[model samples]
Target: MSGPELRTERLVLRRWRDADRVPFAELNADPRVTEHFRSPLSRERSDALVDRIEAGFEEYGFGLWAVEVAGSGEFVGFTGLAVPSFEPPWGRSVEIGWRLAAHAWGHGYATEAATAALDHGFDVAGLPSVVSFTARTNVRSLAVMRRLGMTYDPADDFDHPVLPPGHRLRPHVVYRLTAADWRARRTG
Candidate 1:
């Protein structure tokens, strides 16, 4: 689907491109980038993931966007909205997420892109709430969630249903932002 493009002060969140495939594969394969994932994706698997992301945009009008640096147009990574493929303890919900090249880390890109995505999900899509989750140990993502004003409750933690039992990344923490909360944060 030709999804809407979102612009931030330093990033552009847009649909994937043919040129994005190679670097995206590289990013997906980077051990640092994939540390939280099950494993680094093979080239074929990365391409397949891009295909699925595009299909998701087709079906939902929203999906993980290919992020690029604003002026340089350098492909960094992605940040956007998605529906979790597996059911979580909180039940079905649209999620906000991001992943950036290691070089893109510590620059506030994730939080900035994610803020725009949240605006779309809550303001444009009229979703009542959006959720985000990560391995309990992923402090970077957890901090981004807080920066975006998503509140976490320890009670919401759960083992990722897709992960094997006892997997280190199995235990996950969930954070959520309601439309009302988002509006308040924006105006207040």
Candidate 2:
């Protein structure tokens, strides 16, 4: 099932398309873009990820949306809500996330696209709260989480379960925003 589309001042967050696969793979392969993860994704792995993302939409009714620049319609990346497959201490929760091409960075695209995703998660999906996390060293994503008014507590930090104990990216920091908090931020 294709997910609902969202629009921002500078972006269009919509479902993935066949045209998006190549660029998505390229983005996934960029070391600069995948630096927060274990390693850049191979083409096959990237395609597989897209398959899973599409399947997530089918099963959950919400999944990562393919993002594009509004006017030019250039595919930049993806941002949306997802259900974390692994168990965390916080229990079941939806996550708002984004990934963009290197050329899309520093333009606030992640922040813009993520805001729309958060709105849908809270306003449309009726999720009580949403969380975002990243490798501790990912200052860029951490900043976006802060901009979205997500609160962070060091106590919430955890070593990523999918990563080996000694891996540099295993250490992760989490940020959370409740529907109440999100609504407050919007109307206050």
Candidate 3:
């Protein structure tokens, strides 16, 4: 099932391409951009990530999209949904996430792209609910979660299994939004 292309006010969400590597690698290399999660990714890792995203597009039909500016056509970053690897408070739930180039920050692009992705997840994918999560100290992502109308689930917070036992980033906070919650937010 091929995913349909989606658009926001000033961006286009499409599948990854070979030519997207350089821009995507650059985005991954930015320390500020990857501060929330792990360290900066090497070019090789970034390329591999693009490949993984491509495969996800084919397998899941809705995965992290290659986000580009409509006018400049710049590959800013990606924003969409994926199944979280860690066992979560929501059980096995789809996750909504985003990562933009530093230059793309403060311009509402993350929110714009994510809003559209959420719409697609519910309307097209027919998902019942979606979850978004981040490090406990990642205030920026937390802010975006709140902006997306997600409610904090402190009881759901847990140590990320992928991280080492003593890792600072192991602890995570999760937020949830159901189809009913989304529809209410839409109408309100």
Candidate 4:
């Protein structure tokens, strides 16, 4: 499938451009934005990440597209689906995630962009299910998961492998939504 554009009421999910680098790097550098992450990536690292994200779109027909405000065209950040690389509480899983600039918080952008991504994942990509997870301490992200109609599975929550063994960030909660659940939510 060719890469497709996803539009929401206030955002546009599309391919990334070289022009998005600066804002994208800025978003990655913010402590608040990367609070649950390992660390703020340097500009060079951020550039490499963008390259990988773009490649995923090219190769897989979908990925974390660059998200921008519909009006001023400002780059907010990205939201979409990714294959979780490391082993965790849920084992191997398709994880949906989002990261937006600090200035873009509190406006439901994550929810908006994620809802679009989930739609594309299930309807367009034919995924059987999608899961989201984050460090249990990341209340904000957990709230976003709840807003997206995902439910927590305590049995699925596990220690994240990437962090130092036994670190606080290692404990994570898993939320899941299957295609049927998504369809029901969309129809209702």
Model 3 ranges with Cα > 4 A deviation: none
lDDT of each: 0.94, 0.93, 0.89, 0.89
Model 2 spans with C-alpha error above 4 angstroms: none
Candidate 2: tens digits of C-alpha lDDT, residues 9-82: 99999988999999999999999999999899999999999999999889888899999999999999999999
Each prediction's TM-score versus the true structure:
0.98, 0.97, 0.95, 0.95
Ranking by lDDT: 1, 2, 4, 3
> Total clashes, candidate 4?
0
Across 157-177, the per-residue lDDT of candidate 4 in tens digits comes to: 777777898676888789999
Please identify model 4 stretches exceeding 4 Å from their true place. 88-91
Clashing pairs for model 1 are none
| Model 2 lDDT, residue 33, Cα | 96
Write candidate 3's Cα lDDT for 1-188 as tens digits.
25778998899988887888998899999999988777899999999988777787787789999899998889899999988756775588899999999999998888889999999999999999999989999988888899999999689898888888989999999899999999899999
Screening candidate 3 with a backbone cut-off below 3 angstroms (N, C-alpha, C), the clashing residue pairs are: none
Candidate 4, RMSD to the unseen true structure: 1.6
Per-candidate clash tally: 0, 0, 0, 0
